[model samples]
Target: MVNGEFYRRYLNLPDPYGQQETSFTMLFEFREFEGKMYLKYQREEDTYNLFNKTTNAIILKQSFMKELFVNNVLPHQTHAPDATMNMNRSVEGQAKPYNEAFWKYYNAPVETARDSQILKALSEMESKP
Candidate 1:
C-alpha cells in the first residue's frame, strides 16, 4: 500500500469531469475522535494519470484531515445562485489563495522545502499568462 494501511473501506468513484470512463480510486482510514468517527486519512488515485503515457507512474492524491469538532450546527449555502458547484465548493470560497495565517491557526502541517519549491514554480507559471 506504499507505506500506508489499506484495511479500511476503499472506493472507486466516477470522475465527474472525466471522459472515457475515467474514475478516481480512493482509500480511506477512519479514526474515533471524541467518541465519534471521522476521516483520518485518504489516498486518492488521480484519474488523469493514464497508462497510455510514456511515464510508468501513478499519482496518488492524499489528504489528512484533522482538527475536527462536531458543531451540530446546520450549514447553509452562501454561494451565488449562478454557482456551477453543488456541494464541492467550500464556504465563501476560502479554500483558494492559500492564507498562511489561517493554516497556522488551524495547526495544519507546514509545507516542506520541496513543497514550497513546487508551489513557487507553479505560481510563476500561472503568472505568465
Candidate 2:
C-alpha cells in the first residue's frame, strides 16, 4: 500500500515546512501504443488547502506520473517528443478541441480505480530493485 505521507512528500505542498495533507482524487487513463504510452487524466484543483488536505493539481499530477512511468517503469530507449504536441498545434486545429472533449467523455470512476492499480503495479516493479 502507498503511504499517504509518500504522496504528501511527492507533491511538495503549499508549505514546505508545514504538515499539510492532501485529499484530492485523480483519475487516469492509460493506453499503450506500439512503442510509447500516454496518460489521460483529470483531477480536482487545489481546494484542499483551504481545509486541511489539498486537492491534487491535475496538470502537476499528470506530469509527475508521466515522468515516473517513462523514467521508472516503462522500457524505452530515448526521449520522445511530447505526443500531444501534434494535437496541440494549429491556431485553429481541432486536435486540442478533441483532446479536451475526449477527457471530458472518458473521465469516470472505474477508470480512476484502474489507474490507481496501474500505479501500484509500477511501484511493485520498483520494489524488486
Candidate 3:
C-alpha cells in the first residue's frame, strides 16, 4: 500500500485539470522481458484515467512514468537493454489517438487480471531484507 502522505502529495499535484484526483486504486504488473524485470501500471474501467491522474498530475508525459517506476517503486533495479528498447518502441508506436493506445495498454485483458498478482508481488517484495 502506498503511504498516506504520498497519496496526499499525489492528490495535490498540479495538472491541466487542476486539482484532479484518482479515486480508483491503481494496480501494477511485474513481468520479465529479456531477462529484466519491468513494472507496468494498470487501472480498471478507465484506462485514460491512469495517464491523466498520474502522468498528467505530475506534469510529465507518459514516457516519464518509467522513471517514476524505476526510481520510486523499484529502486536499484536495472532493466535489460532489450526491455528498454521494447518499451520505447511501444511508446513511440502508440496509436494515433492517445486514448486508443491507452485502452490498448492499460485496458487490455492482462491488466484486468493483474491486481491479485500485484498484491502478491508487493507482499513478496516487502518480505525481502
Please give the lDDT score for candidate 3: 0.45
Off by over 4 Å in 2: 1-22, 44-46, 49-129
Name the 10 consecutive residues with the lowest summed lDDT in model 3: 60-69
Q: What is the lDDT of residue 5 in candidate 1?
A: 37
lDDT of 3 by residue, 6-43 (tens): 23223343543434233334467676756776774443
Report the C-alpha lDDT of model 1 over 1-129, residue by residue, as the tens digit.
334634333343453221222344657777676676766665555333322223434334343322323334223537555456443654345235878887776866789999999999999999996
Relative to the true structure, candidate 3 reaches a TM of 0.21
Superior candidate under TM-score, 1 versus 2? 1
lDDT of 2: 0.45
Better of 1 and 2 by lDDT: 1
State the weakest 10-residue window (summed lDDT) of model 1: 15-24
Tell how far residue 59 is off in model 2, in angstroms. 27
Tell me the whole-model lDDT of each prediction, alpha carbons only: 0.49, 0.45, 0.45
TM-scores for all predictions: 0.29, 0.21, 0.21
Write down the RMSD of all candidates, one decimal each: 15.3, 19.3, 18.7
Which residue pairs does candidate 2 place in steric collision?
A: 22-54
